[model samples]
Target: MRIIEDPRSYALVMVILASFLTPFVASSINVALPSLGSELGMGPFMLSWVPTVYLLAVAVLLIPMGRLADIYGRKKIFQFGIILFTVSSVFAGFSISPEMLLFFRVIQGIGGAMIFSNVSAIIFSVFPPVDRGYALGWSATGTYFGLFFGPTLGGFLTQYFGWRSIFYFNVPLGVLCAYATGRIGFEWREAEGEKFDLRGVFLMAISLVFVLVGFSSILSIYGFSLFVVGMFLLYFFYRYECGCDSPLFDFDLFKNRTFTWNGFTTFISYFAGYPVVFLLSLYLQYFHGLDPWMTGIILSIQAFLIALASPVAGKFSDNKSPRIIAAVGLFIIILAMVIFSFSGFLYWIILGLVFMGVGFAFFSIPNSKLVMGAVEKRFLGVASATLVTFRVLGQLIGMALIVLLVDVYLVGGSVAVGPFRALMTVSFILFILLLLVGLVLTLKAR
Candidate 1:
């Protein structure tokens, strides 16, 4: 009855709460990385795995979880995810070794995957097409808000309470969301009778693990071999899914030009953009000689601007062409990357970050709406998962790119601007390519 009265409100609340917690953990943990390393007696490579394991776990599980949500019930999976996340956070806080911490992080990632895959679908289910962008924009704002505050809050907690406090912090929020899920008082079992594709899921998991690890370790023979194996497995997955009665991924979705192009552009946008936060976190702490708390305050600006701009961009998306709006955003991002390449001034670099925020805000919401719009209601879960998967891939690849650049140019984590500049240059080129391709797609669609 409550859901029927205001399904949008219930769904949004659940999504925003859960969504906020994840990014808060994600961005904030960066500030605590050094402390984690020192306390855990972890080297730089092992320290990297703290975040890497979580990301890899989430990326691999997102699609499968979404399929499960679609087949069983979105609410049930989401509730379980929140509980798992909360439990894992507690375990992470209590971890005695880097290995233990990474194991907990992997659990957190599983929870994250369940949450990410379904939230967009749940929101889209409740809101009508015309206002879906508005809802999604608000959802984006929640995510940015988490990112916006993660560093600042995480820094403060890490400074005063210790790095483990950052993990402990997630507990109350996750518990609250777990409670809230019951109040939502409804279920969406869209594919209740469908059989899940277990083989397809196994293949996907294997492929993603290989691909993600391969990219992360890119400069190594093992990395290349893993990548090849992953690709081979992925190709087989595609072949198998194509003929299945209830395929994990519906290949027919690709036949829709808008969906395909939207997916592609989304991939590129993330590939071009996801590196900024990671790079800046290190740049501020290591290169600029800033403390964790100070670094957090500065880094929070980009996400702050994104939170401010996403709703406005989402509103415009309803009435205007999302492609044009997103393209303009891409252009701004390119300009920002170019500025990042050459700028030496802190204020100048901050200015570029502002541009980055505004650009992502404009690109993300409208693009999300467009992608959701392209798919049918029945396939919303898969579509949302697929979209997020591209984003996760972009983030992974961007990290890999940074790793490659750093390994090649920087010796023992020297804060040389050259590697940063080179990285931005590569990003600038990617955005430019994205812009050109987007233009062609827009024109073709018209």
Candidate 2:
């Protein structure tokens, strides 16, 4: 007879496996973007849709799905997510048109939302308070592992096989994770009897789609109008959720200062940093005259450092204050962003990537610990989903910003000093502001 894995061990293993799948697909695709564009015959605006659409779907659905996981069962939802992701990958690999590829990407995003929103909650549910940070750190290491190999391996795959091969790669890994989660022989249903907030879900989905679409298309009058309508709906959604007994999102979580700041700093850090890889991929390829393989290798450097640092940071958060750790990490990211602003050579870029790795390692795991630590046990699903939502939203906004900035500012895809400087300057200011906010949170944590 086979011996069953311990629940905590099972949860950690399964969560890490699932965590690894999303970023592996994502980063690998980032490596493949140039090739995908060329082969798909996509122009700049349509090309931007390739990534943005996936993030948009994930952002819109995260909260509702997290709540659903809480009421139903995390194990059930996670398994479904894995299957969905696996199937979508197969379809995405065979996409003949840009629209078809984007359609499948949205499906993959929904699956990703389901998987990510629950992974932390499942880990938190199974692991003890004392072990939570270290467990989470390990989970983060899985993420960094994906980041580490996505570009490196993704580059190799893209260069040798083709862009389509990247999506094909996620299938077996997703299936393996689904099997791992199933074998855990457990389910978490913290809010089992609670009613699902269908109205709230509808409002949020509509609002986010409009807002992201609008912001992404800000240069156009129609985009501006959609954005305004989205903001209005979002405000209405927040007010409605506040009054609900079983709201999809518990706005009250923000009342805890630590949770609030954790969310804010998380969003800010990601908003500032998420686009770096995308931009650098473009910069290295278009401006520096590097190939996709070399570009991917250089970009993988930051992830390598993250892989090294995440577990240590997670363990550190267990003993020391996570707030302080996150603050330091944010500061390091700011420094790196500043360097990026002035960087014209490869060495400076390498140094900046190293700083980014160090800073992100310090911040991500610790901040995740603090956020989960601050929430009530029953709300873990929502908390986990919210945190991931901030992260994905930040990425969505970051990519949108890059697309808008590049379209309006860059002439013929050239990363001249003018547009590049403007974009970095904006990113720098955002980071500095976030750094100050982090300091405030640190003091409060103390």
Clash list (residue pairs), candidate 2: none
lDDT of 2 at 384: 91
lDDT of 2: 0.84
| Residues 335-445 of candidate 2: C-alpha lDDT, one tens digit per residue | 888788777588999999999999999989888888888888778888999999888888778778777767867778777756776766665566567666765675576
If scored against the real structure, what TM-score would every candidate get?
0.91, 0.90
| lDDT (tens digit, per residue) of candidate 1 on 1-446 | 66545756767777878879998998889879999899989999898888878888889999999889888888888889999999999999999998899999999999999999988888887777778778788888889999888877888899999999999998988887787787776788778899999999999999989888887776789999999899899999999999999998889999998888878878877877777767777767766888866766777788899888988988888778877887777677777877776664678779988998998888888778778778877787888889999898977786678777777667686656676666556655665676567646643542
For lDDT, the strongest prediction is: 2
**Residue 12 alpha-carbon offset, candidate 2, angstroms:** 1.8
